[model samples]
Target chain A: MKITILGCYAATPRSFTNPTSQVLEIKNHLFLIDCGEGTQVQLRRNKIKFSKIKHIFISHLHGDHFYGLVGLVSTFRLLNRENELHIYGPKGIKEIITLQLKLANSWTNFPLIFHELTSKQPELLFEDSKLSVSTLPLKHRVYTNGFLFKEKAGDRKLLIDKAEEYNIDFSLFKSLKKGKDVVSEDGKLIPNRLVTADPPPPKSYAFCSDTVFDLELVPMIKNTTVLYHESTFLEDQRELAFPTKHSTAKEAATIAKEAGVEKLILGHYSTRYENIELFRTEASDIFQNIILADDGEEITVE
Target chain B: MKITILGCYAATPRSFTNPTSQVLEIKNHLFLIDCGEGTQVQLRRNKIKFSKIKHIFISHLHGDHFYGLVGLVSTFRLLNRENELHIYGPKGIKEIITLQLKLANSWTNFPLIFHELTSKQPELLFEDSKLSVSTLPLKHRVYTNGFLFKEKAGDRKLLIDKAEEYNIDFSLFKSLKKGKDVVSEDGKLIPNRLVTADPPPPKSYAFCSDTVFDLELVPMIKNTTVLYHESTFLEDQRELAFPTKHSTAKEAATIAKEAGVEKLILGHYSTRYENIELFRTEASDIFQNIILADDGEEITVE
Candidate 1:
């Protein structure tokens, strides 16, 4: 799985820095997460195909999180997109988008499906043959949800030579790969392990942002292959973190340590601090495997 | 009067090109005209102060024209702007903006005043001591209005020496500047014209975009100092221009010639054209004093 950070700044987009937005490439899905203003331009700069973005997940309704959504949608229509675009966000997202389209008198030719999230509890957002995505409820200034992208272990690989040598029929390979013992032609039960090897372990990724440090979320995101958490402030501004509903680097580290994620990626830095080294130093104290997320940085998870 | 082009491309903002947005500096007012997406970054890159933009005028509901508005508003709030902001646009603009703010729970700390325009006829939108602004209704795909920024003639340049020689009271100077005849201390009537000269002929500017060639608007913007008209297509695409409700370079020049503007500035070029020189060539064919507007180009309306 690979994650590309399109923007990692907080509050506003600047000349060089952009607001929050990213692209997660996992299991044949290129999911766009939290499109802030100027996201289309960022996508163009990063050379990502606009048509590849089939699903967009917005964590919250803040302007910094979803302002670019309508523009991206309009751009899709302009590009003559034929595929249905699925958008998952808060309850009022559909209203906010459809209203703009109504005023412009330009409706998308493609099917625009909206799955507005209102539940505060974890809910299944999207599921496919290869992967599943669920919401990780977060504490923020408004209604917010972080996404969990988990790859489902594929069907066990079939050892054709091993099965053939055991005089197994090709039709029994399907059941053997599904971890079921194959019935022989003479009514002898053959062990599935003898014919098929185990599949690669399932890998999962978790994204959390615009939220204060909440210990309750640790259980849901525990043992994730990779975890991206917003560390808007450093340890110096730890006192302001909770009030503003943003995590400090130390707070983010504590959560990462508690969750036992393989890699803790800290991002969504406030523009006030020029040097982010301090954040790295602070979070490194707790979580040794930490990656500082910046715009245009791509991280791969095994 | 000075005008700065923040963005001038048509359709959508790309990696280097931006959509419609400009700054009209008439007298002391720095009025923002047509805020497209990524306008805030454009403002920063152009070195324009955010505080100077107290007023923003949106032409229509097109995503390319007003998508950046909400983000700009949120940025203003984040910057702790204290001055009230006035936004003048179509009737539904208020609802569109307020809804987003309500969802984010981030109503601006500064008062946001919305002047929704529904009239098809020209109407005065803003007025101060030195400048008066009005709307120029145009034909487009949506309910749109082009803005006319006109400088009100300043108090006739007071000829201090001429007034003193006429033995006119300083208190009566105000009346004389108002182009009224004033009686001197010796009961001599001083002609206002004899004492004062015209105030630079009252420079004016008109901005029109995403519009078709409309002769009805010529009378309202007649003899204006400078005119910036959208030329989304060249002569080759003239046939397509009318259908799209956009003007060609030649069509824009026709309007400028009919309106008798001092200088014609052509902009809002479709991204399909690689070279903008063709726009200048086509426009200059009809009008001699033609200025091709490009991003970051500055023009002084004398």
Candidate 2:
């Protein structure tokens, strides 16, 4: 899995900086997250194929998070996209989009699907043969949710040498890979473990953002391979984070540490700070493995 | 009056080229026209004070014309604007904006006034002591209107020497400036024209965009100081322009000639062309004075 940070700054989009938006590429899917204003232009600048974006996930209704949605939808129409587009966002998203389209009289010719989320608990959002996604409820000034994406466990790898020695037929190898015993031509049973090895462990990534310092998400995101969390402020401004329902670098690192994630990626820094090195420094003190998220940066999940 | 072209290109906002939007500075007022996507960023880059934009006029319901409006409005709220904001657009604009505000649950603390335009004919929209704005109906793919801003005729320059020579009291000076004959203290009538030179002729600017080449607007915008017309394509693409409800450079120049405007400013160039000099050359064939509007270019109205 690979993740590209199109934009990661908090609040308003500046001439040099952008707001929240990212592209998570898992398996065959290129999922867009939190489309802020000018996200389409960022996508163009980043050279991301617009048609590759089939699914979009919006965290909340904040203008900084989803203001670019309507424009993106219109752009898709202008590009003559015919594939279905799925949007998963907080409730009221459908109304906002529908009203804008109606006013413009430019509804998409392609099918635009909406999945309005209002659940307060962690609920499964999407699942396929390769990957599964679920929501992690977050505490913010408004209704918000973070996403957790995990690669599904695959079939065991068959030991070709052992299978040949056991006289296992090529057709029976499928059952052996499924951890099933295979019967030879002589009607003798061959144990699955003797002919196959366990497949590599599935990788998982969890995204957290626009939330206050709370440990409630730790259990849901435990043992994640890569954990991307919002670190809006530094440790010195922890007090200011409370009322705004934002997290400091130290707090985000604490969550990463408590969850036992392999690596912690920090982003969504407030524009008030001239530089974001302080966030990384503070987070690094708490969590040794830290990756700073920046626009145009791409991180590959191992 | 100063006109700042924040965005002048047509179609979607690209990485370098922006869509339609401009800032018209008339006296103390800063009026924004046709806010497309990424306009807020353009405003920030241009160093235009956000608070100074109290009134906004949207020409049509096309996404390129009005998509940036909601984001700008939300940005104003985030900036904690105390001044009232007045938006004038198509009839459905209010619903589109109000629904988004409701979905975000982000109501502005300041007053947000919406003036929805539905008139098919030209009508007055805004007026102050110094200037007035009216709509000039335009033909487009959707319901659209162009704006005409004219500086109200100023008071006649007070000639102190002539007033004193005519024994005109200070009280009559106001009447003389009003182009009224003043009765002197000697009971003799002093003609105001003889005492005072004519005030500078009122300057007018007409803005027309997203419209086809129609001669009906000639009488309305006749003999204007500066006329801005959309030149989305060059003469080579004139055949394509009619179906798209857009004008070519030659067509826009023709309108300027028929209107007898002093200066013609051409904008809204389609992104398909690599160079815009061809547009200037094509327009110059019909009109002598042509100003090509580019992003960040400012034209002073005399």
Candidate 3:
């Protein structure tokens, strides 16, 4: 899985920085998160294929989080996109988009579906053959939810040397790969454990942003391969963090350490700070595996 | 009066050029016309003061014409604009903008007023002591209107030599400049015209775009100081102009000639042509005073 950060700054789009938006590439799916103003331009600058974005997730109703939704949708229609686009966001999202279309007297020829989330608890929002997604309830000024994407474990690998030595029937390979005991042609019972290797480990990615420090999510995102958390302020602005419902770099590291995530990615830095090295320095105090999510940066997880 | 062209391309926002959008400065009022995508960036690149723009006018519902409206509004809000903003456009514009705010749940802190125009006839949309704006009905695929901005004839210019001879009271000079006859202390009636010359002929600017060669507007925009009209095609593609309700360079020049405008500015050229000089070449055939509008070009109308 690979995740590309299109934008990471908060508040507004500037020449050097952009607002919140990212692309998480899992298998063949490109999931877009939090499209702020200038996202389409950023997408173009990043050389990302616009058509590949089939799913978009909005954290809240803040302008910085989803101001680009309407323009992107309109551009898609102009480009003659026929594939269905799925949008998951707060309840008011559909009304917002429909109203724009109504006023412009333009509607998308493609099927545009909205998955409005009103629940305050964690729940599975989407699941397929290879991956599953669940919402992570977050505390913010408005109704918000982060997303956790987990990859499903694959079938056990075959122990080629052991299986061949045991004269395992070729036709029974499927059952043996499932770690099931199979009987050979001579009616001899063959143990699946000795013929099969361990299955590949599943990977998970969790996204949390525009939220206050909330440790309750430790259990929900435990052992995630990568955790991208918002760090809008530094420890010096800790007082401002709680009231604004944003996290400091140290707070994000604390959450990542508590969740035992393999890697902690920090983003959504406020525009006040000109230098971002402070974030890495502060976050490293608690979590050693921490990375600053710069715009256009890509991280690959195996 | 000052007119600045932010963008004038026919289609989309590209790296080198932008779509339709311009800034008109008249009597301390900054009016924005047809906000296409990247308008904010263009404004920033041109170093135009955002706070001075209190009103925005959208010509039509085409995406290329006003796709940047929502982004500008959102950016203003982020910039903490305290002044009220007034938007004038065709019906459905308000709904689209308000719906976006509703969906994002991020309403503007400053007051926003929308004037929805549904009339096909000329109507005064805005007026102040120094200027007035009226819609010029145009023929297009969509309900579109060109804007006619007229700077109200200024106070009569003070004829210093004549005023000195008349011993005009300095305080009464105000009334005389307002074109009012004033009686002197000796009971001598002084004609306002005798003491004052005509205020430097009030400058006017008319913006006509995304419309066909409709000379029916000649009388409505006649004798205007400057006329910025769209010339989306050349004489070679005149066949494609009528069906699309667009005008060619030659056609725009013809209208300017018939209207008796001082200067004609041609813009909104299609990207098919490698060089824009051809537009001026084609237009100059019919109109002597003609210039091609380039992005970031500014003209002072006297």
Scored by CA lDDT, what does every candidate get? 0.92, 0.92, 0.89
TM-score of each: 0.95, 0.94, 0.90
Docking quality category of candidate 1 according to DockQ thresholds:
high
**Clashing pairs for predicted structure model 1, backbone only:** none
Candidate 2, after superposition: displacement of residue A92 in Å? 1.1
> Across residues A1-302, which tens digit of lDDT does each residue of candidate 1 receive?
88999999999999999999999999988999999999999999889888988999999999888999999999999999999999999999999999999999999999999999999999998998999999999999999999999999899988898888778877888898788998766677889888889898889989999899999999999899899999999978878888999999988999999999999999999999998778899999899999999998889876
Tens digits of per-residue lDDT for model 2 on B127-213? 999999999999998899999999998999988998898899998878888899978999998889878888899999999998999
Residue A32 error, candidate 3, Å: 1.6
Instruction: Name the regions of candidate 1 deviating beyond 4 angstroms.
Output: A158-176, A181-190, A194-196, B159-176, B180-190
Q: What share of the true interface contacts does candidate 2 keep?
A: 0.71
TM-score of 1: 0.95
Which segments of model 2 are wrong by more than 4 Å? A158-173, A181-191, B158-175, B181-190
- The TM-score of predicted model 3 comes to 0.90
Highest-DockQ candidate? 1
Per-residue error (Å), model 2, residue A50: 0.5
For candidate 1, write residues B1-302 as lDDT tens digits: 89999999998999989999999887888999999999999999999999989999999999889999999999999999999999999999999999999999999999999999999989999898888899999999999999998887777877989999999999998898888999998899999987888877889899998799889878989999899999999989888998899999999999999999999899999999999999989888789898888888889865
**Winner of 2 and 3 under lDDT:** 2
Task: Please say which candidate is ahead in lDDT: 1 or 3.
Answer: 1
Winner of 1 and 3 under DockQ: 1
- Cα misplacement distance, residue B155 of candidate 2 (Å): 2.1
